[model samples]
Target: MGSQELEEEELVQMVRDFIESESPSSPSFSSSQGLGTFNQQPNYLTLQEILGSVEDTEDEVHQKILKYLRNKNTAWKTTNLKKWLVMRLRMDGYDASLCRTSWVTTYNCPGGDYEYIDIMMDNDENGGVGRLIIDIDFKSQFELARPTTSYAQLTDTLPCIFVGCETKLNKIISILCTAAKQSLKESGLHVPPWRGTNYMQSKWLSDHCQKVQPIPRISSNNS
Candidate 1:
C-alpha cells in the first residue's frame, strides 16, 4: 500500500482500539434471575454516564489532531483547525456552530480594504449571547502584521471570543497574550463588558492556549 493509505489504516486501527478500550462490556445475569429481579431497579447507563466513562476521549482526539498536523505529507492547513474544532466541540456536547468561514468584512479606514476572520461560532442558538471568532495564525502571518492597520483596528464589530492560534503551544500562548494586551487598550469599543475587563481578557486568551495542545511526532514505524 502507498504511505498515505498505510497511515490512514494505522489511524483507523488506533481509533478502533481506543473505542474498544473505552466501551463497557455487556452485563451478565444468572439463568435463575427472574423478571422481577431485572425490574428491581436496573442501573441503566445514561448518555452522560457513557460519555463520562470516556472523559479522556477529548485529550486522545486532541493528540491525534496534533499528530495529523505534524505529518509532513499531510495536506491539512490552518483552516482545517477550525473545522476540526467545530466537530470536536459538538462531539464533546458543546453547542458549537460554524457561523462563517473566511467571513469578509470591510474596513472603513483610509484604504477601505477588507479582512477576514478564519472562523466564527454563533453560540446564540445554543443559549449563549454573542459570537466566538477565531483567527488561525499558522505561520505568524497575522502575528507579524501591523495591528493598527489590520483587522485589529476593527474591534467594534469583532466577537468577544476573538482568538488567534499558532501550531506550536508556546507560540499560540504568545500570540494570544499580545492579542489580549491590544484588547485591553481598545476596551472602550463596543465589546462586552467581560471582554473589556483586563482579568477576563487574560483569562480568555490563556484559556484558549490551555485547550490547544502541541502536535505529537509520528513514529518511524508508522512512517
Candidate 2:
C-alpha cells in the first residue's frame, strides 16, 4: 500500500477507536430521578442557575464545574425547571436553541447530581452569532462572606459566559469582559461604573448580543 493509503487507514482506525471508547472526562447526565424536582422556590445555586446562561454541549466544559452542585435533583416549577435544564446543557457539552420553543432540555445523560451555567443562543433571531462558555477557575479565593459551597474554595474562579460568533466571539473579548460585569449586575451584585451591567441596555443585550467596551485594546501575551 502507498503512504496515502496507510494514512487513510490510520484515520479510519482512529475514528473507530473513538466510536467504541468512552473517555472519563466526558459527562453523562443519565438520571431523571431528582431533575426538575424543585418547588416555587428554586433550591440550590450555581453560577449558571443564578444567571440563566446557555451553552452548546458540543463544546461545553462541564467537568470544570464543582462536583456537588453538578448533581441537583429537585421538585420545582416548570419555569424554574426550564432554566435549570438550559444551564445544565452548557456545562455538559451540548448547545441549545433559545428561540425554538420545541428546544427543551434532553436527559441524554440522566442520573446526574447537578449541572452547570451555560446558555444556548439563537443565531438567527439574536444577531445570528454564537456564544462561548468559559469557566474561569480562580487561582485564589476571597476572604469575605460568600457562598460557602461556592466561594469557600481556596481558588476563586469566575464562571465566564459570553455570546458572539467565531469571528465575533474573538473580536469582543473586551465585550465579554463587559458582559461579565453586566452579569454580576443583573444578579443584583454591585460593580464599578465601568463594571456595571451591560444588560442595562436591554435593546443592546439580546440573545447573541455583542458589546465592545470602550476600553482600548491592549496586546496581552496570554490573550
Candidate 3:
C-alpha cells in the first residue's frame, strides 16, 4: 500500500481499538430497563451499545419523520419547522416538544445555543417511554473544513437527519470527536473547541436546556 493508504489504515485501527476499550459491560437500553423520562439521569453508553441493532421503535420513528418531511409542501425555516413538527407530533398523541440548549464559554470549549425537536414516546418496548432526539441537520455538525479520506468516510455514514436516543448520540459524538482530532493533527490544523466531545454533548444532553411544548392553535370558532 502507498504511504497515505498505510496512514489511513493505521488511523482506522487506532479508532477501533479505542472504541473497543471504551465498550461498557452493560447495554445502554433494554426492555426491562427502558430509557426512562428525560428528567432521569441518562446512562452512559459505550461502543457496543451504539453498534447494536437499532431498536424497532427507533427505526419506526425515524421512518415516520422522513415521511413527514417528504410530504410537506413548503420549504421550512428551522424555527418554524421545529414548531410545526412539535405540534404535529403532539397532535398524533406523541409527547413532542421544541428543545433549546445553551452553554457558557468554558476553558475547554466555546458557548452556544442550539434548537432541535424531541419526542417522548412509548415505542412498544414493553410500555417504556424514551426520549428521541431529532436533529434536522445532523450530518453537518461533524463536517470539517478539510478532512482526511478516513475521517470523511466515517462521517459519510451519518444520516442527514438524526433521530435517536441519548445513548446513540453519546457514542457517535465520542467516535467523531476522536476521528476529527486525528484528522486535524494530520492536516496540521488546530482542533476547535466546538468540535470536541463535550461541546457536542452539550448541544443535546445538557441539563440547562429548556424544553417548550407548543401551545395548541385554537380556531376562530373557539372564541
By lDDT, who's the top model here? Answer: 3
Q: Where does model 2 exceed 4 Å of error? A: 1-54, 57-122, 130-150, 153-223
Model 3: per-residue Cα lDDT over 1-223, one tens digit each: 5785564455334423433432244332221233324312222233324534577667766656555555554413333566666766666566778999998999998999988888887757488788889876676688998998667655655655577889879888988898889899999999989989999999999887898856664332210
lDDT winner between candidates 2 and 3: 3
lDDT of candidate 2 vs native? 0.31
lDDT of 1 by residue, 50-166 (tens): 212321323343343334334533323223444454554454444444333121222321111112122222334577543233432221222223344322322211211223321
User: Mind giving the per-residue lDDT tens digits that candidate 2 earns over 87-141?
Assistant: 4443343453222111112232111111112334456656774454322211111
Higher-ranked by lDDT: 1 or 3? 3
Better of 1 and 3 by TM-score: 3
- Positional deviation of 69 in candidate 1, in angstroms? 6.9
- Candidate 1 versus the native: TM-score? 0.24
Q: Provide TM-scores for the models.
A: 0.24, 0.21, 0.70
- Strongest candidate by TM-score: 3
Q: Which parts of model 3 are misplaced by more than 4 Å?
A: 1-52, 75-79, 123-128, 217-223
Candidate 2, residue 161: the lDDT equals: 23
